[model samples]
Target: MIEALIVGAGVSGLSCGIRLREAGIAAQIWARDMPARSTSSVAAAVWYPYKAYPEHLVIGWARTTYDELMVLRHDPASGIHVRNGHEIFPWQVDEPWWSGAVPSYRRITPAELPAGYRDGYVFEAPVIEMPIYLDYLRQRFEALGGTIEPRTLASLDQALGASDLVVHCSGLGARLLAADSTVFPIRGQIVRVTQVALDTFVLDDYGPSGMAYIVPRSSDCILGGTADEGMEDMAPDLSTAEAIQARCRALEPRLGAAVVLEHKVGLRPGRPTVRLEREQLAGGKLLIHNYGHGGAGVTLSWGCAADVARLIAQA
Candidate 1:
């Protein structure tokens, strides 16, 4: 089997490892901390195909990941669910954003909208509990005889010498590791409440300058948060947390009672466009660059992985 070394163990790294195994390639992921210990866990894992990606792949990637997770939903081992919900708001239904792709995706007739919502559409999409989902990917990787190495790499050259190929799934780490000044960090903050009710998801475009949303996971209610802002360090900012909660509480009542299980944060490795390029290194190392999904990492994970793996195969 062809052996590959994958750097950075986020969803991209994990998903890429899983796909490589399916293609009969042996893959190992090396990271300072495991995938779940960081950004992958902080996401309110919404699989929405939004403006975050190019039209050719954005919606299509979310659609493909949804289909794959559905087949596994029946298996108790698979920690995924088909979460049905709506993208809601008041005064913003003009030129509705979620009209075409999701099933039963029609606007609630005037009589159907809740009192507070001016109007909105109900649509069904898969919401993943990222904690379990991350673990599941790790299991699938090992089941296929893949390896995961957990360590803080001081240099990319360390892995460069031993492997036939190196995939940088390092997320924000690439800013230094690959000398990629293009990859800066978008800070996202979220509150996981030990509180939840209701079976679906809620997205309120009302960002206080507000793009607020609430996603339910099995253990904790994942409520969030967003940004169009970039910060250099990967630290959670308090004012940002307050702003997200204030918006979310105004939108959803249950989460309003939120007893914080954890206030989590992550630096989403962001670029104007996601880079899925391949490079031959200074010493002739084969590198597949697959970072920069911004906030849509889970939504685009597997599909992006397929593209990354295809490029690596050709390289």
Candidate 2:
């Protein structure tokens, strides 16, 4: 029997384990921390690709993930909801390269444009409540005869002794494990506040103040964030949190009175492009590398996992 070891417990790693198990491979996940503590948990996690590149490939993965997410949205336990939102821009531009990925997408009307924004587009995409979604994934993976062990690897080579194959879903940890210099951190911070009356997500990437977005969940809403590239600080900066609130409040003043809940910071694994290729290890075992989705880790999760399964099958 073929056995596999996935090296991270984040959305990417869990999704990979589920796919591999579904393919009848004996798969287990090994992580340094629990899924809830992963950087994935800190994401606004909307099913839209942000800061990931190489148009053609990204769109295919994003589109596949979008279809899957829409299906998951119907299952309340999945913690995915198809939410309507607008992506406002400071100036008019060409239709987004990945616009076709979403089920519904259109230009915003003059009245719909927010104050000070030149143009915008409205679309309905899955907004994942990370905590609930991660828990759902963990449960689903375990139910599929998958196991998760909390073990940190000093190097990628360490997993070779335990399994016939290794799937690297280590996110930023890949920088050290894979010795990939292109992998770096895009530090992001978000503020979770008590729920307001807002039902829609607002993403204003070109706001004068910086990139700001509001993602409303059932119990609370996530307001974010900063995209400080190469920043390794995991601790939340109070000033950045306040600035995020100010920007989000500018989008919807109703957020003014929302009580502060918590702040989170995560290092998004920023890379020029995602790496999802296979390699042969020194000891005759197989290794599939699937890291560097950046902010699209959740957006591209399922598609990447499916691809990894395909690669393994062909091997």
Candidate 3:
């Protein structure tokens, strides 16, 4: 029986573990931190392709993920929901390359535009409650005969020695393990507030006001954030939190004095482009690299995992 080992247990690794097992390969995930404790959990986790490139491949992967997420959204236990939201733009622009992936996408009318936005679009997309969704993925992986081990890897060579095929989903850990200098950290911070009676998410990441988004889950809403490139500090800046709250309130006046729940900081795995290719090593061992997804780790999770499984089969 061929066995495979997947490093890192964030959304990417867990998704790959599930798919590999479904492909009739025995696979296990070994991670330094559990999925819930990883950066994937800290994400607002709405399904939008952000900060990932080259546009050609990313659109395909994002479309695949969108279709899969739509199926998962029907299952309440999956912590996935197709919520209506808007992505605001400061200037008139054509629809995004991945706009076709969304089932319901349309330009916002002149009346719908916010105070300073020239154009916008409204669409329904999957919004994942990270904590619950991580658990859902974990349960699904175990049910599919995949296993999770609490282990840390020192280098890719160590993983290659143990299994016939090794999948590297190590996120930012790739900087040290894969010796890829291009992989760095894009630090982000978010503030979680008490649940508001709102289902619509709002994103205004561009323009002079800086990055900001409001994502509502079942129990609470996430107000965010800051994208500080090359910063790895995991401490949530309270000032940033205040700024985020103020901006979100300005976007939607209904967020009046909502109680602050928690502040979170995560170091997003930043890279010029996502790496999802295979490398062959001595002794007939293979290493499939699938990390550096940046903020799209959740957005591209399922599609990337499916592709990784295909790579394993071809190897």
lDDT of 1 by residue, 28-109 (tens): 8888779679678777777775435565656666666666766767776656777777677676556444344455566656
Pitting candidate 1 against candidate 3, the one with the higher lDDT is: 3
Q: Cα lDDT for residue 294, model 3?
A: 86
CA lDDT of each candidate?
0.74, 0.91, 0.89
Model 2, which residues run further than 4 Å from truth? Answer: none
Model 2 TM-score? 0.98
Query: On residues 39-155, what C-alpha lDDT tens digit does candidate 3 reach at each position?
Result: 999999799988887778888889999999999988989999889998998889797788888879999898887888999899999999999999999999999988888887789
Q: List the residue pairs that clash in candidate 1.
A: 206-210, 207-210, 207-211
Considering TM-score, which of the candidate structures 1 and 3 is the better prediction for this target?
3
Stretches > 4 Å off in candidate 3: none
Each prediction's RMSD over C-alphas, in Å, is 2.8, 1.1, 1.2
Encode model 2's per-residue lDDT on 142-260: one tens digit a residue.
99999888998888878877887999999999988899999999999999999988899999888998999999988899999999999999899999899999999999999999999
TM-score of each: 0.87, 0.98, 0.97
**Model 3: which residue pairs collide?**
none
